[model samples]
Target: MPSETKNDRIFPVSPEKNDTQNIELDLLLQAVFLKYGYDFRNYSKAHLKRRINQRLNISNLETISELQNKILWDKEFFRLFLKDLSINVTEMFRDPDFYAAFREKVVSVLKTYAHIKVWHAGCATGEEVYSLAIILKEENLLARTQIYATDINKSVLETAKQGIYSKKEMELYERNYKEAGGKGELSNYYTSKYGSVLFDKSLSKNIVFADHNLVTDGVFAEVHLIFCRNVLIYFDKLLQNKVLGLFSDSLAKRGFLCLGTKESLKFTDYENKFQAVDKKMRIYKKLYIPK
Candidate 1:
């Protein structure tokens, strides 16, 4: 009595599908959030795709779905995947102009504070962390200041704590230190051993390296200065605004916030809350906007 449909049609029907890799990728991110509690949902989609594809290639998996399955089931694979996604790209005295500007403009203000707190958010591998320490040491503020360096990736945090780096890297680091207005040779802080350099243990005497995800974590300290450079470019606008708000809450009155040369407070909702200390170098001072 009922008319035969595709079941009785001449050609056999293939399974119905709308399987785009992007869809699978979104699902993968959602699964990761639910299963692991690491929020990568709002990261730049293009960046996520590229990094995920790289993982796919390395794992010999054919699709994002396959990679997602492995990531959910295998803890080790998830660690490697997190490392790939969090991509720690950093160097000591990166963009020497920023450090030089900080020394000139920010150090004088910091000297006024008897006890100072500094937060280095998204400190990858601690290159810049030690760079700041060197500056504070030269300025005689290291003894009075507490430096808190945080990164989302635990592996990088561990590496940052060790404070070891390749000798080859020191060549560029030394040049940068001098350009950033170092008074003495950068080598004075570290000893060479087996083609590597071990930085002075005393440099980290006041530094606290910890795992803190700006995405998932709340404000951890009220500080005199915050250095978060080259870390926001990877986040989307929403994430950027969210993290910027966190920074606003964490900074003390008239505290300074330093970003990468390419990053700025312009176009952000809190742009009005900060006045540029060095607009060209991307340093800003929090304003006392009456609530």
Candidate 2:
């Protein structure tokens, strides 16, 4: 006997189905990885989706296939897309309360160490890196400390290395500074030139800004403290756990981990590896356990 299927029972498909956006997105990610060597395949789907949608609009293309065509054919589009893709929203002393809490807590423990190694993961535009440098300097540890400031975006990394920022941001940064228990006038940190600011050169001299991916990359340095603020929010649970494991592995024994206010390790697999140093701030102290 033969089977007769209704016309409406067909699979009904278009080669351009949006759900295949995943397949298309993987292609584009591969293209970027091969062409630019910046791998972003592990980033959460929501983060990638927003960036891809924005890029699709900019290219005036309704579908992922169209976007891929343009991305493969035009290099400039990828450059623009890269800027929009990597989250770069940052400002000096972003969370005054966090800094204040760190001063009252983490710095006290750090004072006991003869030297310090800090890793500022995803250091957008270098504001937080410089902020840490200033704090370490005031604490008399800057001279004995080394800082590694890393981000996946090259453009923002360049800006971070340059240590230049819009002078207009100073008012807000200053308010944050004062709120963070700043010891002196916030203006003392930088000199205004034209409409921009050039932070003191001494602040970033010990900082090394480099390209590092939280995914698909090995640890570049041993660090006593790793401050990865506001970065894990965009990552899915899997990537977040992977990054936490990497941080925990890279961290020196009994090192400290400071995360953003909204981010925490309570749900992560590494939860048992680190003890809460400051529960309110998500600052943790790597517990001493025999291997």
Candidate 3:
């Protein structure tokens, strides 16, 4: 006997059911883009599915259609949904080896520049932003550097601008700082209050926190260095290429670009545009071919 069930009832699943769900998901993404300005159309479908399913479970919604209806009708609910889609998993001095390589290989080249402009794309909550600031300060380059740290989520940007983090995170951050070849104590960079730590205001003096979407936004600035680690993995191949093109256009000739350990420029349209500086750290320098 063929039966259809709802609300946790055991029923025979059909291929048609999966097709319908995919269509519903597509419609929901389209609705989000039309209603809000955010574009998630080209995002990785697998990543989208996991995040959407998690939101559904959290909101106790039965279907993607139902979720879409709430998102469209309730502005506050959409804000919550946007947070779910945003990737905010970041820590100070993440991948210590990458920072070590940056200090060893990239910092020396940056010294030659009179003024440095850095773009930290997808800089969620600004932990790594401050980490870079601390490095620059130690290397005597902070005074001449201006870092633009941008993210799509305004809520996270607000948190980033405040530069406050839970004190509980300091132990791990301190350990990461030491491993990243810190010249002095990590504790010198922040002050503790109640249960949170506020990073030194000087660390953020040259940083500008702004809302920028990598999916739909164009070239932000002609930067000397770009740190967009662990961000491209969430995008599909097409979006990855599009964003890489934007980065390639945004970077100055002979500028440096740093990606996550798992991310790379291989098989992309911009592969030949960059030469690897530290392949293991996913660092690359733009080629200086004459135009």
Task: Name the best candidate (by lDDT).
Answer: 3
Model 2, residue 167: C-alpha shift (Å): 1.2
Cα error, residue 233 of model 3, in Å, equals 0.3
Candidate order, TM-score descending = 3, 1, 2
In each prediction, how many residue pairs overlap at the backbone (N, C-alpha, C within less than 3 A)?
Answer: 0, 0, 0
What root-mean-square deviation over C-alphas does model 1 reach?
A: 8.8
* TM-scores, each model vs. reference: 0.93, 0.89, 0.95
User: Which stretches of candidate 3 lie above 4 Å from their native place?
Assistant: 1-15
lDDT of 2 by residue, 8-33 (tens): 21221354565677787888888888
Worst 10 residues of 3 by lDDT: 3-12
Global fold similarity of model 1 (TM-score): 0.93
Q: TM-score: which candidate is best?
A: 3
Better of 1 and 3 by TM-score: 3
Worst 10 residues of 1 by lDDT: 9-18
Q: Give the TM-score of candidate 3.
A: 0.95
Error of 1 at 222 (Å): 0.6
What lDDT tens digits, residue by residue, belong to model 3 across residues 1-291? 554434232211466865777899899999999999889999988888778877876677777899999999999999999999999999999999999999999999999999999999999999999999999999999999999999999999999999999999999999999999999999999999999999999999999999999988898689999999999999988999999888889999999999999999986888899999999899999999896
